[model samples]
Target: MSRKPSTSHFLLLLIIIITVAVSAARTSAQSTSLCPSSSVNPEFCPINCFRPDPVCGADNVTYTCGCDDALCAGVRVVKLGPCDA
Candidate 1:
């Protein structure tokens, strides 16, 4: 006969599964929302259009811009090169 899982074992398994699912969902959500909508062309408004916030890193600095929507907030990170006048 097969042995059934104990209560503690079942609870642990449940926790692990939930954690994995949540982590996966979070990662996918981040990837989607981290980039601005392609419909918004940056060429039209170069200076103030794509406002990016700076994030410091060990080797290079990164910039992130969030969508200031009425319901939800989203962010996009872009690498800034040399500034042109």
Candidate 2:
């Protein structure tokens, strides 16, 4: 006779999936070491976080800005050098 999977097996599978997702998220956060800061301070936040625009920060580094403006935080813009171009 054929048998069906038990509820415990389903629960185990769900827990494993959740654990994998959380682990992946942590890995992503740690991988973004280039963005040392967040867009919490306007002083460092980009004036215009338009895509296809690059910003040279006070840290003496240039970054291609995302629409969210999280990459260029806690620094002033030196000039424009969009990454796409």
Q: Of the candidates shown, which would achieve the greatest lDDT relative to the real structure?
A: 2
Q: Can you write out model 2's per-residue Cα lDDT over 1-85, one digit (the tens) per residue?
A: 9999999999999999999999999999777554334545556555564455556555666666632253435455544553332
TM-scores, in order shown? 0.39, 0.43
| Deviation in Å, model 1, residue 73 alpha carbon | 16
Q: Which window of 10 residues has the lowest lDDT sum in candidate 2?
A: 66-75
For candidate 2, give the lDDT: 0.59
Clashing pairs in 2: 44-74, 44-75, 54-82
Question: Per model, how many backbone clashes are there?
Answer: 0, 3
Model 1 CA lDDT for position 53: 48
Tell me the TM-score of model 1: 0.39
Q: For candidate 1, write residues 1-68 as lDDT tens digits.
A: 99988999989999999999999999987775433454544444333425554432223333233332
